[model samples]
Target chain A: MNEDKKIGILDEKTYSNQIHLIGRVGSALLLMFMLGIPFVIGTVYDCMPKFSWLIQPSIALLAMMGPTSVSEVLGYAPVLGSGNYIAFITGNIMNLKLPAAISAHALAGVQPNTPEGDAVGTMAIAISSIITVIICAIGVLVFIPMQPILTSAAFKTASNYLVHALMGSMILNTFGKGKGKTVIKNKLMLPLVAIAMSVAGVLLIPKFSSYQGYAMLVAIVITIGWAYLLYKKGVVKVVNRDEK
Target chain B: MSYLDIANSGLTYTLVAVALSVMLGLCVVFYVKTRKRALELGISKEVLNKVNRSTILFTIVPSLTIVVGLFAMSAMIGTAWSWFRLSVVGSVSYELMAAQTTVASLDIADTATADGSVFVAVMFVMSIGALVGPTLSAILTKPVTQNLQKAGAQNNGFSPIMNACFMLAIMSVIIPIRVSTGGLVGLMVILTAVLLSMLIDKIASKGVAWLGQFNMPICLLVGMLSSLVWAKLLG
Candidate 1:
């Protein structure tokens, strides 16, 4: 009976429905909270921003961040799966939440964009969000004393390199696990080309430096195009596991 | 009241408290729902526990970096507002940029002499500007996931390749920034991390199971440590 129940739970339709329900409700609540903060601050302080005061700053910020925000949602949704709703609200998607979700999926031996992987990713994101709130709360309490140490030059440099280290290691870990020439070629070539192009754009084109805001979007498009071409050429085969 | 006083006022604290409560409540709701769903789906407790532990460990360093950022921001905007922003929608770079842009637009030299009006404007702009990502994700994630699933259903290999490409795109953007700024030292650190991770993977295949879970974090530490050494040698 227990085994039968376990098998029943793996039903794709039921799992997807539940995830959809949770994501919709969670996102609606989060959107409310996002708007509520400013409203609360404005009302409580009795310093509601004038309509005019909001215009220039809003334009400036939107001009800089608008495209990046759109691209982030589009890019991360597929990788993050159901965790996207949770992660978007908690913020820090790039630096913290996404990595945690990926690590959780890897640890559980689940692949991304699947029902099982979605559950694992969601759980991981929840735990990470809880930990982040706790850490930030603690940091606020002891911030005065910790300020000097945290801001020290040595620590700053380390923190700066941290993301690069994390990302580089992740890439190598994925690349090193390739099983054949086809997998290696398909997986490695496009990214290497994209990186080279981005580096050149940064160095050679002064205009590209100003448009660093769109660099990630541009890189993603290039890689996706390359991957699609490979797929069309039959170099990228889609293996159907269920058939086996 | 003065801007700093307003920034540190009881009202501001109340705002933080309210926002924190809402965030916590949502987390609990999501947690309960996700767990119930997972159990009903028949996922083993062992797998769930492993993922939970690994995620908590993975979050520590990055969360601390955010804390470090919060400290800097608090010095500029007062503890209450800084805490509220960073705890919610704001990141270090975005919050700082938003604050600076707001102040500059008003022609204020610094946040020190800025009034409540400036504070309100800054907060408003920051909050509104950040709405795009979460809003779009909330509305689009389901449709997007369904499409990806449909694509995968037709060809399982397509999903994995798409996933790999997405990761590569992100890394390609990040690698250049580090290389551009850190120069030789940054390159050395990144190369060290890549090598360390590859080496760990090789060892893990030989039966060191625990190391596989920790390969990224360990590589991060080694890369940071190597940067210090490189900095000294290059100087």
Candidate 2:
């Protein structure tokens, strides 16, 4: 391990380069697989969809999901760091990947957007993805037998609240104490204002519900502006330590 | 084979299995490679192991929830497509909405009566609609990370503040949705989770270090399980 560390120190840049290269290649291949699956199924089943059939729903979904997709990438990439590649491929960004990354960083005693944080985030995402795949695979295998139990009203109700529970825990853990509290203290007004604005937007103007998709984006923009004001006012202290 | 036969055929099952295998294989490969790089960065083995273990623990509930989602989708599409699509990209809700849109567009009474061509179209649209995130991430992550790093370099607090704002923004949107939709039971779960998390953090701060590792998962389980009680009382 000592010898490995010596080599690691000597070749840190090379290692980073390798990771970047591999990630790009892996992502490209995964993209092909994603696209390829439908095509392969179409061919083997001898059921080609007409262009119009493809275009109509595609346009509808793209219209609905396009902006949010853009926002998620822009918003989450920074927090995810190197884990962006894996997280994006595996899906479940907001609920699974982001929470896992944040939780892992907290557990590892690292702050986000740092080398240690990035490393920990990447490892956490990888493990989380693996576990998700395993569990989903098992679920698929037993889905026939388990359908009644899994789809039960009691289980369904609990499952519906799962995200609430997960996000509640995540918010508390991520912003509960220490550095998180410090950051929150300095910028508490931002979230409060954003939350108020979101509630007002979603509730007061029912017609504006069409634009409800942009709620997160709007809140983020508002919070970023408020944070900037705090930064300029020197209310929030930016701490930059040397990379360990 | 007819449309229904094709949909439920051995061939379709084989293809789904192969696709799943490839997906899982890619994840494993990525995990091994990334873990190696992390190790190369000199992260301690102990830290990596702990993170890995805790992450798996944290993921169980959410992953099972996704399974429930998969079951819901299986009602629309068949089991193979539901499993494959949810495993690959898009949440259950997103895929279900896309599938519904296609079904409506085709004017099919139900997914069961839909022909193979209709199923293919549904799958195609679902896959394409969900591609934007991963595709954009693959294209934009490097530049985004670079810009964030540059900003952080100029302002020591930029990255941390930005991260906090991002997280808060997400929570701000989600919490309201949960509150309004989840009702009394949901509210109870959220409050339970928040309070439990605070207690755990307090305990961890008092020197029970191991508890810190399990804090989020513990709170999550308590919150989810207690929802049953809340449900019963509210009902």
Candidate 3:
């Protein structure tokens, strides 16, 4: 409600200035501790050899990812808290069963290049890579027991819908700010680039599923490029264009 | 067999999820006020009004939608949670768990329902957990160090400890989250919380940087705790 609190110009240069060093370090340490638990360790061991390193950070990432996904799906606000609960729970929990991606995504806030960003960035990278490994493991684990369930229930179709529903909501929300043409342009470009990159990876690499990072990076880069182009060309003038 | 029975079960968990959400929502509202010191500044009224409007639209409407959606989804899925009668569709892990449970004859095909009264109790308790977690965090971390000068806390080190404890409690619930919703959904749900946090702060740029930063983790922990408790007690 504090009208003065509303920032007029949010430039990309100084997007999130409130990145706390103590907070990021605290979160990272907590994440490392949480990932070192017995149940988590045991689950990683049982799951596969590749995912062993993931058990700890994945817990933290999952903690972060839940809030992000929910907000995206609902077209609401995303949480930007330090990973307190995530760190705590990861350290203490017995049967940590959260997906690996959540943890990776959660740690995304930890931007390590900046003075305080280093911890967060490391945390993010660590957790995300760990999660990717876990997902690969889960794919392998589920292959045998899951085929019957998948074929019978048409799970691929259902999963596609679920993923689409979630991603569609995210796309709408993310590009909700721009003008009609710009929004549409970015929207069109993002999917096309993502799919094209995905297809390229699928053709080039035997295993398409393992290239999640590549696909995600390509999509992100394309979206960023589109946004930059739109901004540069004055296609999307956000909040008080007449001033500058 | 009856519409009433189906409605009753759907109503129970739907309300449970809503009530849990509301309690946590109120806690977030409360934290926003306290951390921002909105009441003292006399700006809370405007924020409250905006929140109230959004609450009605976001909380109430979605709660209702989920209630109806849950019921319809459950029936369509043909396999509902016996205890709560809530829909378990798209949850492959739960289906697998149900398939694997030999002790309870965890029959995925069994449409046989359990006594609905039990879920009523389960829902009530879960709601309480959701309510308690945030309030407890607020109290424990309620900024004992006070300075009339600065807009922020004086860094007395207590806040950090409280934060640690808060995170620890949330971490504890991961096991239960894994058990009930499977690891994947639990992960997604947590990310969803973060996503919501970012959007909330962007919309409500009310100077409460701490709230913007920490709200998602708090909500994630509280929400999961309640959900975990619900799954544990009911299942």
- Maximum-TM-score candidate: 2
Give the per-residue lDDT of model 1 (tens digit) for A1-244. Answer: 9887567645666677777777777667666765676677677778787888878988988877878777777777766887888788888886777777667666666566666667777778878888888888888889878888888888887887777676666666444433222342345665776788888976887756445537776777788788877867877554433321
- Candidate 2 per-residue lDDT over residues B15-101, each given as its tens digit: 777876776777677678767766766677887787887788889988888899887877777777777777766688788888889
Off-target runs (Cα >4 Å) in candidate 3 are A1-161, A178-195, A198-209, A225-244, B1-235
* Model 1 chain A poorest ten-residue lDDT run: A176-185
Residue B95 lDDT (model 1) = 89
CAPRI quality band, candidate 3? incorrect
lDDT of candidate 1?
0.73
DockQ-based CAPRI category assigned to the predicted complex of candidate 1:
medium
Instruction: Answer with 1 or 2, whichever has the higher lDDT.
Output: 2
Clash list (residue pairs), candidate 1:
none
* Per-residue lDDT of B95 in model 2: 86
Q: TM-score for all predictions?
A: 0.87, 0.88, 0.29
Give the Å error, residue B113, model 3: 31
- Candidate 2 residue-wise lDDT, A1-244, digit = tens: 9998678555644655565566677678667766776788788878888988878888888888888778777777767877888787788876788889888877766666655666778778878888888888899888878788887887877777787788778877565543332333445555877788877866776744344447776777888888778777877654433211
Q: Please identify which of the two predictions, 1 or 3, would achieve the higher TM-score against the true structure.
A: 1
TM-score of chain A of 2: 0.79
